[model samples]
Target: MKNAELVVIPSPGVGHLISTVEISKLLLNRDHRLSITVLIMKLPIDSGVDGYINSLSATATPRLRFVDLHLPQGDSASQPQDPSSKSKSPLSFFANFMDRHKAPVRNVVAELTRSDSSSRLAGFIIDMFCTAMIDVANEFGVPTYAFFTSGAAFLGLKLHLQSLSDDHHQDITELKNTETELRIPSFTNPVPVRVLPSVVADKAGGSTMVITHARRLRETKGIMVNTFMELESYAVEYFLNSDKTPPIFPVGPILNLSDGGDDIRTKQSRPIMEWLDHQPPSSVVFLCFGSMGCFEEDQVKEIAQALENSGHRFLWSLRRPPSKEKNKMQLPSDYENPSEVLPEGFLERTTEVGKVIGWAPQVAVLSHPATGGFVSHCGWNSTLESVWCGVPMATWPLYAEQQMNAFEMVTELEIAVEIKMDYFKGFHGDEDKKPEILSADLIEGGIRRLMMGGESEIRKKVKEMREKSRVAMAEGGSSYNTIGRLIEEVMNSIA
Candidate 1:
């Protein structure tokens, strides 16, 4: 048997890195003849994946290795740039950071090829944002594959919109704030412009960056998405039939379902689990926005009021917003006193009924039998986690492609209730326009609908999808077969 090696390049964000690592594990476990080396990139802001990586490294096997592309000494690329500059968006900043590492990546690839004679360099698997690394793969005379961390539906929408822009010269940025509805093929219903990704909808540099990545995707040998065919059958079918896209592999529902290592186990895990232990099965609503999700004090107060008024057993993961300083590169931190932003005496008022904690162990919380429903920002990973655990969701999208994911969940899948589908909390450097705050009544109504009964339509649908997700990853399943096909393609790529 021929031994082959593949290199994976993931984005700096923890969410993207987690999914990317999961896929790498799947590939390694599926085929014994293959080895994977993941090239890690550092973010200008510390997103705290180092501890997770260190833990993995401590237990890593011979076939799996992690190489950190350390930032150059005294390099400004490691520091936060001017956040006040309106011209820079998050995507652009990330893209520029990745681009600066081209020389280092090339050096690593050169070393790998020179050091290994028994194991042939098969191909490169790059995150969607790291498409610029494709050029390096080309230089080494190897094929490049894109590992899309989001769903197939979002992938289709991105490619379709980019095609429209490139082939027909349509300016999608002009559709921002309009009532125009787009007939995207991936979705069953017409998608409203308001729910478009903030990067694509706005006329910022990020829109151009998104298009560049989409165009680069078309250059890959194949695209492996972190979604199964059952969850996104229409989009998968569309890609399989279309001649425009490269071979599409729906090889996931890939997730990191562990207890999130020691950091999670030691901090707040026991209390949260203890509280869930006493609640009735399917009684508590778990509200955890993504790592980057946070709101202003006024919106936080509204959420507190809604949770109090609903009277449902609840676990809320509330985070403090990042500082508004011009040059600080920071993520949302856990509030020492959540009551500072929440309603007066709210924690005291709901002592028996609810628990408010900072930085939840999301996978652990979702898998708890007491967790009846999820009120999420509709990030794809969170959506998949909820589906995998058979929990229904109340969608409240904040930014990025979350609005698109929410639309698919509510309108297409019918597995989630909607709080506000088109709510856009603009990212850093976005125009100074505050999104409309959802009222307490509106939020409470959505929570009621989400957790009303054990036999609700959405609940049933989520349970059904959860089973499908499992089957998709099982042997002889859709994702399983797709992974086999991907391995075959990788082996065949070697000249």
Candidate 2:
């Protein structure tokens, strides 16, 4: 019989859901006395996490339960409003969407408590975006712990900025256009304003919502960051040293390396693997942006030219941009004919040296022996995956906290190559404004340096971090010990 029960609430996106599930599995595997119930919140549009959820349910233990919250009919939470409206930001939309689920979530918690006599409801583990659910946890008189799907450095940045705004009463919106550098405690170097997350840097967008979430983090029982101390020693140490922040646990490098199942491997990913099988080991440069990353025709052509000119074997996952129709969800679609966006005759010319495909098997590709260098969007999950697989990256951050992630890896960690530190493809309606295009020459230079730099220090560092990542997840590692401490605290809360 389970002794203690934990309810986990995760945000809708696949990246967030994947990390949340991995962490939950880690906790369940570590302590037999613990049971977890994950509350699923569906996205306004189909983000394709349902298949993954179903697979998990098929293999899940009795102690692990998934409860899907019922959405009210005609409830439009994540739908985009008028651009001129104050609630136009996507961050605000997501925050509001999660806020609407408070009633259902509270009811679910009440039911769990009522149904189980043997199991005690220990706490609520909430996703970073689900901070509003803390209110539900409070109503039940249980502590809430935040599962930060991002790295410790980004977590520290959020807390520090929130403190500056709330405690110091400073107007952080003024920092959007300023060229000044701010010295953050987690970072070794002065951080430039341009490298800030677009949500925080954009004055008219989601800065308020972002700051609100950071403020709520301080109220949590403890914050669990999805990064290992060995990888982010300084940031982890910074949180440990600061008394103002709640107890911080760096229990990660938490990754979902599974490519669904064998059927997916044989059907969807066979071609990609077959191609990689032929390439010389560590000869191909793999370029794949995250799920939401895509570009226009102009940017697409520049990248094609760069790959062709670089004269290196390459595997590129190029996606078509989402529909421009008003009130439509902005998700990347697969191109019917990629040549329409590429330079004329480009595919035929480079067919021998490269392959351009849509919807890559990212984890499988990263783990492949042939994938030497990665040209990535630097999403936190992608960053951790690259490190876990020992692949060096050339960073090209498109949105969210990715620019800051790129800055940390390149400038702070010195493990990744820089493609463009401050590349911001604006979120929500901001994409309408034409962002500066990266030229082919600059792209080619980054690719060449990443691929042909020849046993460089960056490569060596990534290899070393890969080993450290393995050690952290092993028995008696830092992340293992941190998880143990977290479980102990939850058990103690029962007394």
Candidate 3:
């Protein structure tokens, strides 16, 4: 048996973990003798996400193990309160966790180095957020590859925007003051500041995450992002040709590897999928804002009223009100009751057209023939999933780099169209009121455009892109070849 081992580090989030598992599987599927160890803290029982990790452990044929690096139990009270939720400030708690835990992770690296298999530690694959892993890899003289769970367009913009930050005198919002265009090398469209990831454009110096990211970009030995070449060929080409850029490998549609098929079949994802099945094809518009995003109760009501008014079939994932207390937050008294919150006689009238639920099987819904369009927050995973499903997007980017992703989808690649935007400036924190929300009228127009009328042009382009995505994963496609080469390279490095 070949004695080679690879350690994969993933940030502690559902999206990051899921993508890492897919790459782990790709490695094992190709090399039977490759021993793999995944470094994660612990699985949360509440979310039922543990199954994904266990599933990989069960199928990795040769040898695979999880090396859990956990936080001290007594420190639970001190555990950062996911500053993301607590602070609306531009700072990211995700980066803070990394900064605080670097020492413990380094200790884990030392423990691995002392093992009998230390000599066999041939490679390290780490999420972009876990930049500290590069130092660990250097400690043992192992080559490291930075694994980006997002698409190429967002990644390209991130790198490009970082460079722009060096020279531009003003912040992202100020850049938006004049309708100035953001000129990135790979993309043809000049995106506005309002369309970039919120974090990058913020002038607040508290968040050093982007600084770390820029540094890692220049240091990593190789770069790997979870996207196929066909879906992001332009961005991929630019990265490859850049001076001093690490070797770029586009390997993904990673979620599609799930044997459960495109639908969310697990108990957690089932209820959502079941509801989607009852809706008619090409008629129901699916809207999901990912796990972390939240909107005010009134915004939710407005969206509900708009969908009802448009007379379009729809499925919405609504978050429960923040606090049920009378004073803390006020929801439409009828909000909990579907009949009261929906248009008068709306439920009965649109019974054939709409379904409202707390959550829905997103992938299955998108892949379904009935789901003609997605109104989304434009997260990288959602964007890629929509592309894989031949579904066109009605982009409504909420926060983070999502706006950047939405801009690329609409303006750069022309696979989707943005809902009309109203920007808010001088907002100190996310907890404050949003500057603008896409009203029902804008949402209705977006749905109509993407579903029919002049929007058919975008739909046709997406369908063709979907074919390209399929081919890239098939027998002789670019992504297929890249995966094969990556496995071979890892194995050869060991020998």
Model 1 residue 133 CA deviation in Å: 0.7
| lDDT score at residue 94, model 2, on the 0-100 scale | 70
Top TM-score hit: 1
User: Please, what is the whole-model Cα lDDT of each candidate in the order they appear?
Assistant: 0.88, 0.88, 0.68
Q: Write the per-residue lDDT of candidate 3 for residues 1-495, one digit (tens) a residue.
A: 356788888877556777787778767776676777778754222133465555555455536667667666644322534333435332443445555556666777667667745347787888887887787788778898889888777777766656655555334334533556667776767767656554554455432467558667668777788888777778888887888467878887777435332224466467656766776667778888765544665566678767877777787776553342322212211136655444467667666777766655577778878788888878788888899898999887665667777777887788987775323212121333545665888777887777774447888899998998888878788888888888778778878
Model 1 TM-score is 0.97
What are the runs in model 3 whose C-alpha is more than 4 Å off?
42-51, 54-62, 76-78, 82-93, 113-119, 165-178, 256-280, 321-348, 421-433, 453-455
Off by over 4 Å in 2: 78-87, 261-266, 427-429
TM-score of 2: 0.96
TM-score comparison, 1 vs 3, better candidate: 1
408-487 in candidate 2: lDDT tens per residue? 99999999989898988965326646788999999999998899657899999999999999999999999989999999
Candidate 1, residue 300: CA error in Å?
1.0
What's the CA error at residue 236 for candidate 2, in Å?
A: 0.5
lDDT of 1 by residue, 309-388 (tens): 99999999998878787554577889998988988899999999999988888999999999999999999999999999
Say what the RMSD of model 2 is: 1.8
Compute each candidate's TM-score over C-alphas. 0.97, 0.96, 0.85
